[model samples]
Every structure is written in C-alpha cells, then in structure tokens.
Target: MRHSQADTILQDSMAKRRIKEVTDAVTHESPVKKHLENLLENKVELEQVLAQNSNIDQLVKAAGRVQPNPVETITTIDGIHPVVKKKSGIKKSQIVYDNDYIDVDYDTKNQPFRHVEQDDCKIPNFANTWNAIVDMRQSKKAPVDTMGAHCCADETQDRPTYEYQTLVACMLSSQTKDSVTAAAMDTLKQRGLTIENIAKMPEEELDSLINKVGFHKTKAKHIKQATDIVIEKYGGRVPNTVEELVKLPGVGPKMANLVTQLAFKRINGIAVDLHVHRVANRLGWVKTKSPEETRIKLEELIPKKLWAEVNHLLVGFGQTMCVAAGPGCSTCAANKWCPVGRAAVGK
Candidate 1:
C-alpha cells in the first residue's frame, strides 16, 4: 500500500489498541499507571502486524514525519514527529472564524466571508436592548431555544459518550442552522453517537447521516479524525479546555468556545455565530464586523455572570425577529432603543 494510506491504517490500529488498553486497565489497582504500562507492553503487537507486510520498511521510510513512529521497528507506532512542511507557494487552506494563530493560507479564493463593517454602530440606548430581548424571548420560542446543540443528545447517558456527542453536535452546528443540526444529531444518535462507534464507522456512512447540514463532507472527515484523537490522546474523553479543544480537526475558535461552554460548562469565551454577530451589531453593542471581533469586544463589555447566556439570548433574537432580511423593527421590543431598529422604522 501507498505510504499515506498505510500510515493512516497504522494510526487507526494503534488508536484502537490504546482504547482496548484503557478499557483493560480500568480493572487494575492502579488504572492510570497500569494503562501506561500496558500501552508500552502491547505496542509491539502493532509491529507484529507491520512486520507481516514485506514492504513495511519502504512504507516506514516513505511515511516521513507522521504519527505512529514510521521508524524501522514500527513498534512505537504512536511516536510521531512534526509533519514535514509543504513546498513553498502552496496556497494554505482557510479555517473558520477570525483566527490569527493558524497559518492556513486564507487566500482570496478560499477566504471566509467577513461581515460588512458598519459606518455607525454606536447606539445611545443600547443597554435597554438586553432587557428588551430577555422580555421578548420569554413569550416566544425560536429554533435555537428549542433545537440547539444542548438539546442534541440524551445527556443522561454515559459521561464519556454524552460528552463526545456534545462535541459532535457543536462541530455539526457550524455554518448550519440550529434546526438542521438538531435533526442531524437525532439521526446519528439513532445510529449510535459514541466516539468509538463514530471512529470506526466509514466516513461515507457518517457523511450521509449528516448530509442535510452544511459542509457535511468536511465535518464528517473532521469528526472521524477527532474521534480517533479523543480516544488515542484523551482516553476517549473530550478535551475540556479551549486551547486543547481547538487542536482537533475542523474545530475553530468558535466551535472550541461553544464546546467548552456547552459540553464542559467552562465559561471562558463567547461563541459568536452569525446570529450573535448580527444581533450584537444591530443592537449597536459592538461596532466590529466579524464574529471574532464581536466575541472579543463582547467579552470586555459583558459581565462574566452573563457570558453563558449572551449567545443563546442574542441568537434567539436574531433568528426570530432581528433577521438578516427585512427585520420586524416596528413591533420589536428593542425598536425604541436599537439604532438599527429605529433606522429601519424611519423613527
């Protein structure tokens, strides 16, 4: 087999091995220590499989600096070096959100669309809009209120599996509407949404399940890769911190922030989806164009106590009344205070 394909197979085998080792270690007196020792002891089993391949040395040499060692012995399959850099002038792939860290080449063709920078985003009575939205939402229900990622799965299930489902729902929700995301999650839950099940499922089948959601193909690949990492690196548990969660494939700052908030209940940052971005701008709460800018600005302005509720509140408002099309400025609760609302109504 080609080196790239073989490398993938090697990583998959080792990840499964690690999962089995973890399950076996749970019965031992020292679970953590026993898991580590068992992993080391059983790593040679991977080599025995690789040794059976007569062309294993060629595969190892051609593998370059990738996961699962790629060294001659192939015993330490999980030991990996940094990936070799691609040749210069290759257009770097773009990522979601206003990410400044990753070097994904956000070239013109692949660049994510940015929000239109408003000329005047400051409104004097903006403080009243928060109360207005809170009052307005109490009487009506929006799609986000009913079908958000928080409602995607049965949380009463096992902790690890439920957490993994939470992460998957967040990933699928990106660039997709809440209703679509909830539906997709429902289908996956029927088929089993656990990490081990998702990791082993063929990417084609997983993609077909979530096909209604936007960018299903990309999300499916990312879900599979992330499940493997969660098992191999995190012992089948989802990473709780923003820093670690963002390291997963297809997870950007937005998804990472939401995962930390919803899955882990660790309120570190606001998840600024399109609804949050539009609502923040329409209320004149933030002048920024992009969601990332909105998130950073909102973080500074909103109190820590309200951080968790901001996204849900604004997303509902934007999704229901303060829509992207002709908004209901006249009848809306914030019409009296919101600058955009007043402008729309010619007040």
Candidate 2:
C-alpha cells in the first residue's frame, strides 16, 4: 500500500482501539465511568456508534450506577477535544468537532477577503464608521477580545425582572470584582434580600447581612434607603429611568447605566466604568481622561445601537488583552486598529 494509505489505515486502527478502550472503561464499575461515558458521547465519531448500540448506554448506566443527562454533544473535526456538558449551567464548550480546524496560511497568495486598511487614516462618516468597526471587529486583524467568555452581564441568566438584581449587583460591584459581586449576590439571595425582604429588614440587620462586602455598613444603608424609595415612591419596583435610578443613594452614572441596561434592556445610556474608559483611551477611539468624558465621546462617535455591548466588550477586553500597564499588544487582534498599539509596535 502507498505511504499515505498506510498512514490512514494506522490512524483508523488507533481510533478503533481508542473507541474500544473507552467502551471497556465505561463498562467497568469504576468511578471514572461517568466521565468516560460523557467523553464517548461527546466524541463525534463515537457518538454514531453509541447511537446505533443501546448497549453502550446500558453499560455506562450499569457501571456508573447513575443515568447521565442526555445532553446534545457538539463536536468539531479539526482534532479538537470532546467537551462534556456540566450541570453548572455555564456553557464552556466552544469547539464543536474534532476535525473542524481553521488554518491561516501566511505564505498563501490567494488570501481570503478581509477588512481593508484605511489608507487615508481619517475617521469615516458616522454610517461608515459603524460598518468599518463591525467589519474590523469580525476580521482576524481586529478580532474582538472575548476574554470573559460567557460570564459578562450580556451572557448571564435572563431574569424576568433584573432591575432589583442589577441595582444589588452594581452596589456590590463597587470597589469589588465581578466574582465577588456574584458571591455577594448569592449571599443576599440566600438571606432573602428581595424587594419585600429588604424593605422589611432593619437598617442594622441589613448591614450585618451584607457585612462580608466592602463598605458593607454604607452599602447596607444605601440598600435600605433605595429599597424604601422603591417601595414608598416607586410602588415596590425598581425604576426604569436612569434619572430615577441615579436619584437613589450610592447610585452613580456607572451604576445607573448598568442597572438600566441589564434590568430594563435599555440602551439609551452608556456604562462608562473604569475598564471602558481605559480601554477606549488605549485604543485611541476616545481621547478622554475620565470615564464620564469617555462616555460622552463614545456616545458621539459610536452608534447608539452598540452602546449596550460596548461596556461588556471593552471591560472584558481590558481585563484580558489590554492591561492598564504593559499590555500584550503584539498578540492583540485589535492592534492594527489601536493607535497606542501601533505606536508600541513601531517602537
């Protein structure tokens, strides 16, 4: 047989052996049986076999002593590893197939059509700007930084009424990180800090409840005050307008915009947090010193339709790609478009 044919045969034999080993592992009454079962189900080629043979499921159930959740396993073909779905509700599986691969050949003469570099380097018209940014963001040269994965506000579980939740999260997020805010939210939920509960709780008791978070005393006070305003003034529901939201104690523009966006799905305002400000300046998109200034500049430059996603994207991008000091511009996909990054490269 030809060398290529022999290699293919060898690979096929190895795949078969791997499948058998996986099957045998699943059949054994071992602790790893559940994991092996998931692995087999997630593997594209193996899924076909498992679907044809009901014995595989029986073997897995018998060995593991537990019925696995019938999750839709997504697989790719470019040598990507299989991903098992977890019950944690967080989707981490992006690679869909083992054979699905994206190859960018540097030496190839027939390059794929991509975003064109602006020769004049002048800001295009507002309509053209939106399209240009979108095209660049989608291209390899200026690919969007998706560091936070699905943990961002946009990706979180859709609450029926997120106004109260958004307020609580924003308050907790002050002088705190997202992970910390999530924990504090969980703690508050466990302690029943709903609109009704918060309205009823005494100020001192509320303080004690949220004492784990920084500035808990002040936050508790603000929470009580806000809850009272919501109950007495707003009929026990969080306000929809940014002006009304910011009228509450401890509610600034950043918090107000966050609450407005996440709770009411309103894109009328921009959340100009520190991350958004820093990243915008670094990219030379908005020449502003403060987040408040950056917000106005961005509103003028970027379209209103993209206002909602800007904060989430820029915050995630800031955390992952553009560090405040000593950013990794060389590996950044937005380097081509970033003035600061281009300057760094020139240096």
Candidate 3:
C-alpha cells in the first residue's frame, strides 16, 4: 500500500475517535475524573505507539507535503474500513491500504487554505477607528473638544500648544479633576507661567497656585522639581521623548506619550489613559485588563500612522459618548462597526 492510501485510513480513524472522545467527554454525567480516565484509557494504546515512533526528523525536510500517521482506532464499528485512492491518474473509487500516507502537490496557487496564529496584540480593527474619527470630524459630528480642534494652537501663541499644556495640565491633573487642572493652570499663568517662573517660584507659592487641584502639595513639589530639571537639563524646554518625559518625577507612560504626541507631533506613540484603555477593551479593540497592558497592545495592533490619533479619538469618544459604567453606544457614530455594540445588540 502506498503512503497516500495509508493517510486516508489514518485520518478517517482519527476523526471518528476524536468525535467519540468529545461526545463521551460532554455526555458523561458521572464524576469528571472517571470520564477523563475512560477517555485516557481509550487513547492509551495509540499513545504508546506514537511515543515509540516519535522520531519526526523526516518531517522537517518534507516542505509543501502532507504526511499521515498510522490509524489507531479506539472503538470498532462495523462496515468501516480505512482506505484511500491514489492520485496518479487513478479513479477516486480505486481503493488502497497502508499504515501511513503522503500527498505531494507542487501547485502552490491552488493549495488548501492555511490558518496562522496571530499575536494577541495584533488588532485589525484599529484603522477603522481612525477612519471613523476622520469622518466624524469632517461631518462636524465629533465633540467640540476633540484633538482636531487644536490643530491651530501650535501656530497661535494665544493658546499654548495642547501637547505642552496637556503635559503640564496632566501633571497637575493627577488625582484631580479636569476642571480643577484647568483652573489651576489659569491661575498659574497669571504669574507669567514659563519654565523660568515655575522654577523660581517657591514651593509654598506653587502649592498655593495649584491648591485647587487634587494632591496639590505633592504635585506642587513635582512641578517645581520637574521645572528645575527642565531648565537645568533640557535648557528650559521640556524633553519631547517618552523616555525623557518619564524620567521626570511625576510623569508615566500616559503623560509621556501625551507629551510626545501633543508637543513634538510624534504620532507613533499612543497615550493610554483610563478613558482610552477602558474604551479600547470595552470595544474589544484590545482584550487587555490593564491600562499599561492596553497601551502595549495598542502599539502593536495600531498602525504607526494612526497611533497618535487613537488616544485622542478614544479619549474624546469615551468622554462624551462612551461614559464609564454607562456607555451610550446607541447614539455612537462607530456603533455599527464596534464589536461591543454587536455584543450589546446580541448580533
């Protein structure tokens, strides 16, 4: 018997045994341990043969070829015999027998479909988010405070660049509300809110300025120290890289990436704040359980071209539409494309 004939017998027998094993595992209501024991016993003889003939050195060299092992039946059913037809101009009805088989086909164009495992962080839906946001912005359907609205801030001196302001504000915004951070920045700007002024201000005075924000005492110390470092090390300018920003006393990946995106126009980094992280996972854009994990995953799945805008869109979307604990998916623009929406609608 040729290898081709043997493969058919092996595959058919294996398929039947697999079906029986699965059925028994599911239907057996007795102790799970007993059912598992029976299943293991059923495969014991086959396992021994496989263990004995485990040398698969030939497989490595047999590229673009399919090989089948010997048939090992777990149960004997009547009227069933393992046989396969040859492919050398033989009719399909012509039967042959063997313990093993092989199939060699050189036509790569018509090869059977192959499935490959993807990395957990590789998300294909990320571009959809970018396209959706661009559409919403073009149609004037996005919120008033979306990142697109600040494109002119870099050119105009009246409004500080959102990235620079965002970094300072985020530093002050820690453990504090957004409203409070805005108010604190407003008050600080009255005293000539430059790096020099911030570095020279006494800790007590800086604390007074940001006292309205949360953790004002600790934040005040960080702000003063960070400003001093910026003046001394970065020459009165905040470093734009994530590595440099994270080295500051109070900055983390979120704040650093935000600074990178907002200040320097580095769009390859993603800022995964609570809002971005929550909405990403909730939307099944990324299945991570933590913000840090979500950030790493987003960096992998999101195309570099769209990385800068992902956090901005998700943050804005999370704020106005997908509120935590009560996401308004019904009225969301991306609702049609969102997996979460489909799950919610039972589709």
Candidate 4:
C-alpha cells in the first residue's frame, strides 16, 4: 500500500512479460494445438486411404462427402475375399467376384481398376447361329406354319375380314397350342364368325364354341369387346401398328407384334412366345428370364429386315427340333453353335 512509483512500474513490467510468455506457449506449443494438428494429419491420411480403393472411397464419399485426393499409398485394408481357385490363370488376388472363368486383366497394385476379356458366354454370335437355324427350318413343317396367324385367311376372303381373323388367331394363340388354336379358328369359321355375328353372340355361347382352347371364357369376352372397338373405333379394320393393336383387351406385346406382322404385313417387333423363349435360350441366342426380355433382346440383335422371318423360323425350330421336354440336339444342325446342345450331346 505504501509502494513507490518506480517499484510499481517494475512490478507491472514483470507482469506483462509473464502474460506474453503464457500467450506464446498457448499459441505455438500447447497440448490442445498439437492435438488439433494431429487430428488434421490423421484426416488427410484417412482420405488418402479411401482414395486408394474406389469401393471404400465410394462408401466414404457416400457417408461423409469426402473428396479424397489421388494417393500413391494405400494406408487402409479391403474386405477379406474368399480364395477362389480357377483354371483361367487369373491372379487370385485381383478377382473379388465371380468371373466365370473369364480372363480379366489384373492390376497388381490397384484393388479397384480391372479389365474383362470378351467371352462367348456373355453374348451370342447371332448371325451365324441365325443362318444355321434358317437352314434347318427348310425341311421342317410345324403346326404353326399351317395354323399360324398368317394362314388364317383363305384366298376368297376380303382384306378386312382376313385381317380381323388374323388378329383373332394371334390373340387366341397365347398360352394355347397351335393345334388347339387351329381347332378354335376352324370352329369359329364353321359358326360364321362375321364381326356382326360375333359382336352380338353371348360370351357363354362363344366360350362353348372355343371351349377346347386355353382361357376360352375370358378370350370370349375379349373377342367381343375387341371386335366392338375395331368396328366402332377403327371402322372394322384391325389397327395396323403395334401401338394401336395393344390397346384392345387381352392384347399383349406378343399378340400385337404377330398381328401387325401377319395382318398388316408390317414387322414391328419380334413376337416371343413360350416356344421362341425356350429355343432362344436353349440355343444361347439370348440369356433372358422372360419372353418379353427375349423379344427386346432379339430386336436388338436381328436386323429390321429379318424381323418377320425370325419368329417363324424360331417357332418352327422350337416345335420340331427344340421341344421343351426333349430337344433333338443330336439331329440339330445348330447344335455345333449351341452351348446347351453341345453340352447335352457331350461334344
């Protein structure tokens, strides 16, 4: 309390110097600062680890939006993959998934980048196999060849009636054998299946007429309803395009494609049914699970000019040689090109 001015000044100067020393230590060499710098360095290391593996990088980026930089060193580990033994001579370390004996180029250092060699099992040689099938079709005559949508009309019938009959036949052929479908068409012809008579006939009576065919009851209703639409909306002419043909009740893509081809002589698409589906896969022309998938795939492979003939050839081949239960692989000319056939015959 009784200090002199010079003593107070010296004490103040000492206090200022001590505060500066504490500030400098906190800013440059504190434990908290070191911890933060260590954390930033670890984060860069983590980013580098993620950037090295694309799979991990994707997972990290998805979780944290981390834009990892290009890294030379991988400081992380990938998931353990089972050791798969194969005869294709691919480096076991490079393959993480099933390669199906396909020779894939391996990068010894990179876990992400890979190149797959083209394999015959991946896709078909369609043109060569297609030619083989057509050649086989020359000697064979199937139920479809005589009883298909194309053969529904006699020479005496007018154009509109012929087109309508062809549409009706295509519609009836779904899920029904060609023989059964032919019988149904014959009965309809015997019953004078004019559009006027069919339009007015009771569904029950019509079903009784086509009772032998599959799903005759619903088909009876569809026939009457579709005929009404044809008469009312299309002036009794069948819709010429696949777009318009598919509008009718019970009319699907298969029926629509066939109707357009046979009725209007315009091949819009491949009409894949059970036969085409089976034969296409059995011959390795396509690898599909459904007729629709086969239809789409076939269109991509087959040129537009050959679209009309493909269904016919494939159908006949299916009915004659490639029957669902027991395909005649030994006798089949395409067996050499067919994977399933070649395997079946042990060639």
Best by lDDT: 1
Tens-digit per-residue lDDT, 1-347, candidate 4: 12243244234545335433433344222222222222222333233333443333242223332222211000011111113354333332433421111121221112221112233123456655666676676667778777776666544688888888888888788767888888888889888767778888888999999888766776888998999999999988887765566668768667877776666666666678778989988877788866766776776665555555667777888888899757998988878888987898888
Compute the lDDT of residue 187 as modeled in candidate 2. Answer: 70
What's model 2's overall lDDT? Answer: 0.54
TM-score of each: 0.65, 0.55, 0.56, 0.63
Error of 1 at 169 (Å): 0.4
lDDT values for all models: 0.65, 0.54, 0.53, 0.62
Model 4 pairs in collision: none
Worst 10 residues of 4 by lDDT: 70-79
lDDT of 4: 0.62
lDDT of 3 by residue, 1-347 (tens): 33453344345656446534543444222222222323333343223223433322221122112221212110111011224444332321343222111122211112222222333225655445445644553444333242222221223333233444556776875544455666677776667666666767899998988888755776888888887787788776677655567668777656766565556556435667777887887777788755666776776676454554566556666666777656776766666667887666654
Candidates sorted by lDDT, descending order?
1, 4, 2, 3
